[model samples]
Target: MTEIWQQSPDGRPLVIDPEGGYHAAFLPRTADAPRPLAAFEPFVTACLAALPEHQREPGARLGLELFLLGAARRFRHAEPLADEELLAGLADLFERHGIARGRLLDLLGELPALERAQATRQVLDEGAATVEEWLASHNQNLTVRVRERLPDWARDLEA
Candidate 1:
């Protein structure tokens, strides 16, 4: 079924950037096709990369959902997101697109791992190590530990 999203159920719009301040038009639905959010994942993933940087803010969190709806509403548009950025991109996503905040957390199952990866990246960056070194060293030991704890498919290419 072809999808159509006027805006996220909550009502923020989609915005992104290499520099973080672009807005896409929100077109209303004129068709009856069910909006399959799952289909928008890849597009949301790509827009996640261009999302703006901001520290915690409760009022402005639906970024990911808005992007998902936008792209699902217009899928033929951009590139898919890379695996590494998906979760962090998503954390930011929740704020800007959430319909009921609770709705924002539909994928709560993914957060623990996402947090671990972000922490790993922070530790690696602080250590000033190369990506290769970060992978080789036990510097961000949490990421490794988390991978060890999860099922095989949960692991990344590094495994």
Candidate 2:
């Protein structure tokens, strides 16, 4: 949720967190604007590098890389790559980094949507098991279209 996109001078997406909430050290300045596909590894490396020595192990690095990738996917502006090209590029990136392809693919599967819905469910409370139930009981307190996605936003909860 903290992630946001900024457009580079060349019009490619630049993912950032303005509040310095997530991995603040690596925020790109104007001079460092990256080419689209080339941006992923360098950003991940910088964020991982910012962590203390005790936390710089391979597994931790892989997890952070995946989490950042998910956030970037959620916020990055539209680009022209075809689906196959994008996936292939990602797969190559993972291969180069020693991360498993299956892990990358699994991370890509509706993870961001599920994460948002899960957060909303927590905000609504444990007893609120469905979107309809949540809305019906509390609809008056909020604005319209705030959660118009309905069932999708509450997908993590039981019906």
Candidate 3:
């Protein structure tokens, strides 16, 4: 099947070649799309659901990276996002990613959305920690932790 997310907003074709390696343009989505971070929720949910049974490290890591990068894109936009709207969206985004998704939904149920990304980068910056960094220096114990969290497919990656 065609990649659902690869279709651009205006319907232009978008190509993402996993083999080509790191292409900046291939980020989660444009930094300015409407509800971009929130858009990641479903994909995150898929990852969380698939991880325990899927055993594909690359898929797991890619899922997290794509979802977070999508969130990061939303955050990176220069335009102002309402704090309440953004926070709500972020909570929704996280809930979508969280395995115990209900708690996040409940916690965010009454809160105003957060827009901390534009107020400062500190919060959004936290999301910038990359899989590469996580994998590179993790102590053997941490490595095991990372391995457990990752889909089995990602284990053989060379970086």
Tens digits of lDDT, candidate 2, 1-159: 254454322333334346544321122224464334564454433333433442434433433444446433432333456554455555555555555544555455544564465443243332123223332353332212222322332333422
Q: How many pairs of residues collide in model 3? A: 16
Against the reference, the lDDT scores of all candidates come to 0.33, 0.40, 0.39
Q: Pairs clashing in candidate 2?
A: none
Instruction: For each candidate in turn, give its C-alpha RMSD to the true structure in angstroms.
Output: 15.8, 16.2, 15.0
TM for candidate 2 is: 0.37
Regarding TM-score, does 2 or 3 come out ahead? 2
lDDT winner, 2 or 3: 2
For residues 1-159, write the lDDT of model 3, one tens digit per residue: 133243322243444456633212123433576664443444344434545544444445443443344334444353346654454455446544542223333223321232232322322232344322333443223333433545433432212
- Put down candidate 1 lDDT per residue, 1-159, tens digits, no spaces: 222233332343333335533333233333573333334343333334433332132211332333233233233223345422332333344444433323443424343464365432332232232222333552444334322322222222123
* C-alpha TM-scores of all predictions: 0.22, 0.37, 0.27
Poorly placed runs, candidate 2 (over 4 Å): 1-36, 50-63, 74-79, 110-159
In order of listing, the candidates' clash counts read: 13, 0, 16
